[model samples]
Target: MTAERGVHKPNLLVLVGPTAVGKTRLSIEIAKSCSCEIISGDSMQVYRGMDIGTAKITPEEMQGIPHHLIDVLDPEESFSVAYFQKVCRSLIPEIASRGRIPFIVGGTGLYVESVCYEFQFTEAGADEAFRQEQLRFSEQFGPEALHAKLTEIDPETAAKLHPNDQRRIIRALEVYHLTGTTLSRQLESQTKASPYNLCIIGLTMDRQLLYNRIEARIDEMVQQGLVQEVKSLLERGCSRSLVSMQGLGYKEIAEHLLDGLPLEDAIMKLKRDTRRFAKRQLSWFRHMKDIHWIDVTRGENFPDHLADIRAIIAGKFGIPLEYNYKH
Candidate 1:
């Protein structure tokens, strides 16, 4: 499927699944087989010094396969779907130009879909004063009050957003203030067409087993001193209010340290929240079109799963499968 644009758009292989569904290893193997460079689609992995929490692929794990977009921003810096889309648009073509496929790999459905579907973010410029005012309002009147304001102007969007999601709520309000158009309406009008030929692979497993993996991953993260990871960021003056610090592992652990929550309670909350996050990730991907699902069950032979994925890539995208599997 070539793009309508005069120039040829390269094929994109996207490997997306719920957290701890085993995307990292499989993606590396696929990249090796397809001769591709990976572009991480994860929202949290972009932040530097956030390795353990984000389960960022280490240099050892990457095994010499070039990766883009990980560890690019400071913990205090902000990242957005619009920024992700812009970076990927440039990186994808540059990777293609070098004769390597660009593999968009992560569980961040919104970030990946924004790139694949080519979402057009609102053209309305940011009103810093309005945003600051909304922030102050939230701090003074609380998040619920701020959310109520959104309900007045954009009930549809407010209904979808959590009261605790103050960033998005403020942004939605800012959009209405700037352009007199609701964020939901602006998104509704955006095109969902892709400029690249895409083959999206979704990984899955038995629900109980997936949950078990999530629990184990959380345990491993704790063992890796996830608490210390958050402590270092805070010590460096990174605020809890920053979007990066609000990520799953970092936020839960930060609460224990800063807000005086019990350590065990924080760990439990982290595990529970991570399980819920995985469920949400699955829900998001289910709505995506044209994904080839592969179920990798617990105790299953991994090489067999890799072979299955390789065959799909070759058959669907006409990419050569040169993966050397020593079966």
Candidate 2:
């Protein structure tokens, strides 16, 4: 890591944006130019069988860039922001020690923020019986009903999470149950300080165009056998209730395959939900500090955007990047 004056921390590069906003391609380009080892900030990409739906990066697409935290867990295994924070915290220094900048890239806002800002979560113990009870309540009264409970206890957290995001909702309830203190309150108490010299970039574009891109991506996923992928997971005895199954594509497709909904309807729901999810992701990242935002609406001019981002990184870290404008 090149030492910036007065900044003793190791360098960390983060590229974050809403889904379907071109983070993956841009991140790869930046990493190529910056000598970065990327650690995925995406939450769902960890599950092993969730390839096409989660849009897991292909080996060919990585182009010799070593990536961490992708496809590391079985579908049954649970992953959380706290766990992501712990693992990513360790990876930063290790990657830098190898003389590569640690680049975190994806749209999972809270998970990325926790690592960047060194967020401290409450040490609330889990209650198996309580968890089961909450699960039963959600099952009986529906997820929205359970979310209403969280709304009463911690409205800030509930507002951030989708009603169908039962795992985090239940965890928030559990924290409240254990500590008599709200989860949001604990998060608010965090220092929001980083242990790394950070260079954060956010990509955005026109909303309708982004939504169109999202729908197009979903169409591509369907052609890539997304339904069959979810079916395979289900046939393997992976429950629809698993956190892995709760991801946007998996949830909608599972409903279609198992609940007899039409595939077209499922695709429509997936598209709409994904658009909203992207909006939420943007909302979350915009609230973060020090993000150099770049509008990539004119995707035909990607070289220009890439040059702009290169400049941002070069300016942020006081390092030179090789670029040829006429690519």
Candidate 3:
């Protein structure tokens, strides 16, 4: 809705876009202009050893802007939307207290949505045995087979999830097995009222151009030693089944490093998976309400786009932004 509803509510500024759509550079610029601290909304960036593949921001890239919820967990530890919500909700007000806007920036649609709307996850009991069983089923029959199981139980949620998203697909299945109700049903029942006054910005570009960027980024990662990154994690005894390993870049490369998937094939799969992931991300964000969408298809015009975004933020939040406009 609005960036600031009243003095009673704190403001939250969120920037969401599919992978390789250029959120990182623009986010830093926006943060600098708005005096904001960024909280990474991505699930994978939380893991410490997953730098190159996750596109984790370097200290130099942050450019003195504070970033939270990144590199905070070991690759072996699990991160859930609940944890994201808890940490982000805590940080939002803390950042606001310091007179800085709490800016959430990344492409993890569900995780960002959960914090924005305060999604109350159902306390559906977990069945470890059932979870383990499903995991085994996925490994044996492939992730598509496991995704098919969820489709039979809850087609709505299954449609949003990628077949390669085994972590979420299995959780949806587990929720159904435990509660006898669809995860989609539970989500539909949750309140959409947000506690913070929100300004949500979504970035998009031409689909073909985005795919080209995704492929090029993957190629860059290979040159940056993506296989070695995965190899290091595996050498540290991180399981391939770990949620961190299931992320787009890590999963495909790990297959190459461990199970002898050819490097070429692995890179190809990673590129394809990332493209699909970006599509799914767009689909997810489309359902969210009140996002101001900006098209950044022309990479050379980023300065103009950045000025436009700053205007949007200034108008929404009623804040003064410091920037020099060139004619």
Candidate 4:
């Protein structure tokens, strides 16, 4: 909640916001100047074969800066906020030892928050029966219906999750029943305080423009063979109900392939759903105080946008934005 990244400590810069607001491009530019390495904060981008649908930047797109945590996990493997915070804790110090700034970039708010706010990951282990029951509920009633159940039991967790995130929905319900406590309370009770001082820079833009960009990007993803990528994952034994398949584009497309809906309809729904997801992202971000919001839409041009960000980073960290990108 506090944006006051203390002086005299290694800095961790987290760039987060609604999707389709140019986070990847902006993060790359900032990383180039900051002498930093990009650490992907996305959930779906962790899977190796989920390139286009996740809008993962290629090596060519990275322009030679190293990126970590993008393709480290198999599609069927489970990935949680606890796993992300664990990996980031190890990775940040290594990056700092190399004298490059550690920059985290993605629209996944919980992933960003888990690091920035130093939220703890409490492991109550698993409840097989509860997990199965919740999974069955998700399968029968859908992610949204389970989400409504979560709202009934734990509104805080429900508010944070998108209705399409079936995995999290199942997990939340499973946690509530397994521990006989709300996930929210357990999170607060078990949080291991972090040592890192953090700065979070959230990027946002106009709603209409953001939605337009989301739709356009969805079109581009489909054209770039998102369907083919999903098919490949399925052929590799990743099931439709796997944790990976619950990601935004993956679920909708998989549903289209299974049910009789046209691919076009699925594509349209995916775009619409993504736009809504972005809106929810913005809503979630606004609730967190002390966030330095950059309205890219309000800027007259890219340089102006860059200048505002550069100034904020300088003010926060007591270091000039100029650094060796040529390395």
Best of the candidates, TM-score: 3
Candidates' lDDT values, in order? 0.86, 0.91, 0.90, 0.81
Q: Tens digit of lDDT per residue, candidate 1, span 1-327?
A: 333332455688899999998999898988887899999989999999999999999999999999999999998888988999999999988998898989999998878998998999877777778877888898799889999999999998887666766777887898899899998897688677878777899999998999888889889998998989999999999987678987888878888999899999998888887777777788889989979999988545789889888998887666467769654
Off by over 4 Å in 3: 1-4, 324-327
Off by over 4 Å in 4: 1-8, 187-194, 298-300, 323-327
Q: Candidate 2: minimum summed lDDT over ten consecutive residues — where?
A: 1-10
lDDT of 2 by residue, 257-303 (tens): 99999999999989988988999999999999989999999999899
- Residue 324, model 2: Cα distance from true site in angstroms: 5.0
The window of 10 residues in a row where model 1 has the poorest summed lDDT is 1-10
Clashes of each: 0, 0, 0, 0
- Candidate 2 global lDDT: 0.91
Candidates in order, TM-scores: namely 0.89, 0.96, 0.96, 0.91
lDDT of residue 247 for candidate 2: 93
Model 1 residue pairs with clashes: none
Better of 2 and 3 by lDDT: 2
TM-score of 3: 0.96
Q: Give the Cα-based TM-score of candidate 1 against the true structure.
A: 0.89
Candidate 3 clashes between residue pairs 3 or more apart in a chain or in different chains: none
Model 3: residue 257 alpha-carbon error in angstroms:
2.1
**Candidate 2 Cα misplacement greater than 4 A, ranges:** 1-7, 324-326
